[model samples]
Target: MPNYSEKPTIIFDMDGTLLDLAYDDFIWNELLPIRYAEQHQCSLEQSKQTLFSFYQQHNHTLKWYSSRFWTSQVGVDVLAMQIEQKAKVAKREGCIELLTYLKENGYPIWLATNADYAGLQFKLEETGLRDFFDVIVSSETLGHAKEFIEFWQILASKHPFDAKNCYFIDDTEKVLNGAKLFGIEQLYSIQQPSSAKAPRETCNYPMLSALTDLIPILEAQTTEQAEEQKKYA
Candidate 1:
């Protein structure tokens, strides 16, 4: 077994990193347009164009991640919609396996998500993944989205984690860039955030093809660190 303390805190983004993002895509992309058309008594295309315009304006802001904000803006109860389709919420491939490995190995685990507190609670409840994490945070509580360095600063201020000694895995490049700007050294991106979407061939940071891919990287890191410590000793 590798040295447990040498393992970096594994920080994860909830929607795409641990949980499948296809469900979210369906809710926002497919179902939402239909709902908006029904509500506004407009053509489906017009509803889609209007909602898409709103989406662009708030893409990475705190409002974009909030069900309440979306509900008010779109006149659709997004939280209720999610609850109605709760059965579709699912873990990504190898999510539990990798989480179990880290939990058993005593690596600190955290979930830092742009999801709101209400959304986070229900998803955690639906997946029963709450116990595996040492810390779970929502940007709703922090008052900043993951796309900004302020989110990282506020997160560190509250949780007191070492920026250089932790790894952050997110599906969004802008969010990963935010972590990098905040001095986090180890960062990863999801190659396929939504199974419905094509896998990314390239990213600025290393991309995880599956959750289990992280384990080998951690193990190799342990070997390299041990050799470095031995050389210095």
Candidate 2:
């Protein structure tokens, strides 16, 4: 069972959580490397290694801001071009419906992601899902990934939802652990097709294989809340 004392504000993660982001894997692993190799006169394997090394070394750096990775590696304006390219390759699944249901029922849905704005915008536009969120927050805006407990505190100060009455759903176990550390009442680790096994400390809360599974519970909760509000009125 989901462990919330009452209906709480829902925070969602984008990318591989609410949206299937296999497109990114394909781009990074295949398309980007091939393009770089073709443009730079290097072996495809060497091109892949170069880009992977940069990402591995600077995964959290704001180097993405300058689009240097694209310039230095692929010799093209990847930030702009990747928008349409990723859309062509991306796919939406059941989670899209769940997000729509949550919005229709008036849940205060906030999106928390570690993605850069351009990347986040691409995914949302590709999936035609920009309107599902009340606000889409990137850790870039927060100045850190959600893995930092401090980032959650900053979010609480700005958003002011109850920690004991909040539902944080994310596919990354590292971010989930950060939520748990900050005393979020319910932490859910989603199982996307691309996600790996639950990392350590995942036993602290429930596991959901798909966002669709939460639809019934949320619908019931919404109905109950409406009925209670009517009675009080």
The TM-score leader among the candidates is 1
User: Highest lDDT, which number?
Assistant: 1
Residue 90, model 1: lDDT of 90
Q: Which runs in model 2 stand beyond 4 Å of their true positions?
A: 1-6, 60-76, 89-91, 195-205, 216-233
lDDT of each: 0.93, 0.71
Clashing pairs in 2: none
Compared with the true structure, model 2 gives a TM-score of: 0.78
Provide TM-scores for the models. 0.96, 0.78
Model 1: runs farther than 4 Å from truth? 1-4
TM-score of 1: 0.96
Which lDDT tens digits does candidate 1 get at residues 1-233?
Answer: 43434668899999988999999999999999999999999999999999899999999999999999999988999999999999999999999999999999889999999999999999999999999999999999999898999999999999999887799999999999999999999999999989889998999999999999999999988888888777656
Error of 2 at 94 (Å): 1.6
